[model samples]
Target chain A: MEVKGFWHWVRHTLRLFALYGKMDTLGLMRSMGMLLTMMLSDTVLNIAAVMGMLLLAERFGGIGNWSKYQVLFLLGYGGLVDGIINVFFGYNVAFISRRLGRGQFDHTLIQPQPIVVSLLTEGFNPAFGLPSLLPGTVLLGIALPHLVLPQIAGWWFLFAINMVASVAVVLAFQFAFGSLAFRAPRATEEISSSTMHLLMQLKSFPLDGLGAVLTGSLLTAVPVGGVAWLPCRALLGMGGGVTSYWLTPLLSMVLALVAVVTFWKGLQYYGRVGSQRYSNFGHRN
Target chain B: MAVMSAAGFMGDNALFLIDYLLRFLRVILFFALWRLILHGKGAINGYTLSTTLTYTLISEVFREVMECRTWLESGFWDGSVSMRYLRPMSVFAQYAAEWSGGVAFRLLTFSIPLLLLSSLMGVNPLPASPQAGILFLASLLLAVFVGLGIEYLFSGLAIAFRTHPWIFNRMRAAIGEILSGALLPFAFMPLGLGKIFSYLPFAGQASTPLSIYVGQADSPRLMALQLFWGVVLWLIAGRLWEKNKEKVVAYGG
Candidate 1:
């Protein structure tokens, strides 16, 4: 059944999480060890990425017209987006093609819940999800003081909106690409991962110096710039025009619309035909 | 895994396509970044635009070829590693063979195409000198062994700590990027810092070979250093494995 209303969705999601959140096959000591290690490694990885950019800015005064603080802000935004993706769709749940390819989408279909709600909550993982948040928050804490926003409240409001938009854009983009598993499940099962990797790798790159053609391609063709760079420029007051403020949110809405449509259509086809590869023996990996 | 099954081969093909495309875009982006930074200047720390581009191109291709992770982790984590004990070949020999097979596929499929794409983009793949070319190949061969040493070291750590492969793998790649000069060249760092990083064992992985290729560092001294690290790392990894052999936690009956 399709979940109705925002509160209803939240209720169902919470119930499912409360029931199944403790799905750690690794046991207690191992799980705790894994969490601590993940926290340490994630921090190191995040800091290293940001440090490289910061080092460049330090050496050269700044990257293009952006200051060191501004670059840090951009990376902070990227980390925040990554954290959101991880918390909401941690593990392989975001990689939906695995379900489609391995004929496991039927599990969601057989559930006593809407597929969307199932997906939204099934990957909820806050403990392990804490990895990216620490680094993102720390960097943002440092960068926020350096950025001079004339009106703190308005800037914060804009920051909050931009963050939501960035997360939506990333999730929708990944899902939209991932929905292709309905066609050639085996062939395109991993394509979504490639797309995710594309965004992850390119998101932190300073777009200021890449020139107009490449920058435009990134925005329209890949939407990689929206993950951090474009939103960052707006937040830092570097956006050259008013349209810049609306760009990411608008892109988010458009991409979300596309993703929803693509997902529903794929689901319909999946329900009717079923995955021929489906087997009694589970091999979802 | 690349050579194992039809599904695996197909997966590799898909990955290769996406990887190649990203490589194409990254070179362009990096070229633009350096160009903007240089801003009509001839060089920074004796790295002209040409040498820097060549250095990036070589490092990008070289790093991928040296990758060997999770091959050991997968077996160990699932308890299938014990199956290897029954085979005549030692676990190290089997893994070494497995890693080489994967590396060979990646070199042919991913690395060669990347270099060709770089060449098409006008990045000169030629070494700075004939002597440098010979030295680069030698250093690179040593790099393969050094990379193997690192994989085993980490594998030993995985067994000893009984740690999750997820964090261990991330930690390895993350540390490797900075220390091995994959993210930013050692020369690009502050003068003193660059010199310090260059002496570290990890620098033997990417920096030494690429540095020699780009003519920034063609000294046999660097190759000798790589040899020393390679020997040391392998020895330590072997010792660690022996000490932690019982720590292997194989789940499931």
Candidate 2:
């Protein structure tokens, strides 16, 4: 039954994309331009960030115990997760709050499909996400040989599964933040954006020296450390042992479950608000 | 008094508080990162961890002061800008006045608190001398004007490219993030690249004033360069606004 539901969503999403592609010429052009600009800027910024990290590392005689290749691997892992998120869920997640504010969310609510599925499919743009994959793939290729692969059949299996789990962790964050629209419709955009910005900044830096409390929060509650850091650690065999290697995927699953529950509860609250005729128009009430 | 009693001001304050909180958190995070990076090391590229923290705090405030909040793009897209042409004040002057009001508010509510907090935390440096303090103030004023001039130029370009004003906005943001030295200090970059960035108008936005405050840059020379760019950009923005203002008017109509 779950598999059937998944296929049903895929079919509907593909149809929506087709409709959008057929109709939105000017919007497509503008989005393409924006995507190109973003891609170029993102690549340049990534290079600069890596260089800055390298320079700092050089000044300190290298980041304590982590090589340049390991840092690059972390960066590549981050980029790959971001690229996948952008491709599948980035736009819809980013704009969900705006849609809720504008009352366009009502259209989704009225649809006979799941709200999450509808929200994810509404503004899916494959082209915008394609360029990000290039840099991510390039960086990953450069960092691959430096990684300590497991001496098992298909050692890439762990890395690939961890990458997917990392995507789930990030999506869970987006879902949790995007759910704020159900309560504070007006402030949702600001809340989501600021939250994402903070998380991105935290994730970009090395997590080793953030101490126990922050490291714990990033691994469990926030799960930002799980997004790239832990996965990179697992792949590099720097994770403490078998138990620690499995902890990242376990924590990601738990976060994903929490995100789903949060969204579901938020949807219920939204339904109650709507039935009570509580108009959050322009955030006045 | 009635307006003050109204709910709008409360709502505005609430929004401003949220923005303030986010920025405050960012400052704290960056301070922590600086601590981690330094780790008993004295300085990297001549910047002590304290000075780097000071630079980050000040740059964040300046960024808030210079932010125009997409008013130009929104005005062009929504046709509200046409109302400005009918008024006696020029469009650039109107925007400048509007932005100045916000800047004043931010200075009082945002910049002052941040300055106080950084000083309390012992991250911010006292000006090298009373003369340096005065020079820093003058350089800051010049920097703000230079930022305003660049904003006008970008706004004019947005009007000219009405269908894709976002591209201009994005480019401006990227340039500001990189060349303006808001993220990483330009001094940390290679010497030749740092020199080139320092000469650019964008550097006037944050690096020039902060550099002077930290005593890395000569106040007189940097302030002179900022003044030169300010005048040059002001003229170019005026010309561009004159040429493109009608195009947006027609497009909106």
Candidate 3:
């Protein structure tokens, strides 16, 4: 929280991270009970949240044209995206509206780092963040056994790229929504969280069965489809043909560009008006 | 609390607006998921699109008002639970009243309007028979107590947590979403698992009432089971409250 000069701040942050890393390693010795409790609880929550679709896939042999493994893969992708968000951003940074609404943006303004960099890094929680991925990574492993390799030799490489692009699409969208906090901090503060909830809730839907209009709207307007459906489609060879096979990464790149423009525009507005909201909540140290 | 909450919806709904929008999107997604699964089939294992739509509608409405989430236990988190102890009122009763009032308002404003609109659009949400309708109401009433009891356990168990009580709340909510059949009808469950979950306490919350509404559980046994879980959950909830009441008072907001 100290507003040191730029180089000093960078060095301090590195030192703090090294210390934090050591503490995270020693977390077992320091708070074994709490650590275990969190890990166990996170696993259960992650499984339960995705259990309904999985049960449907298991019992009914998957929804629509999707095979059980395909649905599992989609769930795996969503889980990994969520895991990535948590490990890097967690809810605090991922749901940036809260910090903005609470006038914590002022603290970011004071940091030697750029506001965007601060927003991106402030909520790193690697120690606790990795637990939610247990179910997802396990699911991915389960789905890997059923993988249908495309003729392309770079299938794994392509999937990895899609995964990275999907994360960019999600985080960038969150940033765009969170930027609204600059103008009307309270009103726009929860936009990111709400949209995140919307995305998470709808991301795994087997959207292949819907009509073009509905599917197209879901893919573009909301883009929950972009988060999982299209990516899974690409990976599963359901992208209609080669030209469409890379649709997910393409959509993600377009989304990332749109997100950047929206965010910087919001930042300019934020710089112009600043926040009028007041806060008594102690600054996070 | 119920009346005040009903009034508060009018008083301030800025927070709820976004939540409601998300719920609407979830409902649409639920519909789309079903559309995919049931396409060209007309019906699967006795569930038609209409029935499933009705189920989705009722599930969204009832859970929105009646089902409890982490925020329901905010009194504990914000230390307002201790203040309830200062009053002559029973904390459980107070929560029930608050929840009931909100439920009544939502059933009137949100549920009724939505049902009417959906009905006009050819998805009838009403019960198959008048008796079924009456029983659905009765089952729902039982669910109020069952849900409150469950919320009590959720809050009371986390009464001693030093950090991240919300994790327990999230876990409980996740468990409820699946087991309560609020996410989907237990009909899609493996035959054995469906029957077993139908007997579990969580089923008493969403599954039983919806079952009654759909005329799938007209048997006196389901009603009897709902009654059974109602009493058992409250008793356990009562025990948890007694053990944790002191812990609640230990921290005063």
Model number with the top lDDT: 1
lDDT of model 1 at position B160: 81
Error of 3 at A242 (Å): 3.7
Number of the predicted model whose TM-score against the real structure is largest: 1
- Expressed as tens digits, the lDDT of each residue in B95-122 for candidate 2 is 6666666666666778788887787766
Model 2, A2-113: lDDT tens per residue?
Answer: 4456777789878876765444334446676555665675556445434555454444544545676777677778877777766666444553555554445666678877
Ranking by DockQ: 3, 1, 2
Q: Can you write out model 3's per-residue Cα lDDT over A95-133, one digit (the tens) per residue?
A: 867777767777778886666556555556677777877
Give the candidate order by descending lDDT: 1, 3, 2
Give the lowest summed-lDDT range of ten residues in model 2 chain B. Answer: B1-10
DockQ of each: 0.43, 0.27, 0.53
List per-model TM-scores for chain B: 0.88, 0.87, 0.87
Query: Could you tell me which residue pairs clash in candidate 2?
Result: none
Error of 3 at A112 (Å): 1.3
lDDT of 1 by residue, A1-285 (tens): 554788887887888776545643232236666667777887787776666666677777777777878877888889889888877786556777666776777777788777777787777767666666877788788888898754444777788889999988888888887887876677676676777877876787788777688899887667888899888888777886656777899888988899899988988887777787653222212
Model 1 TM = 0.89
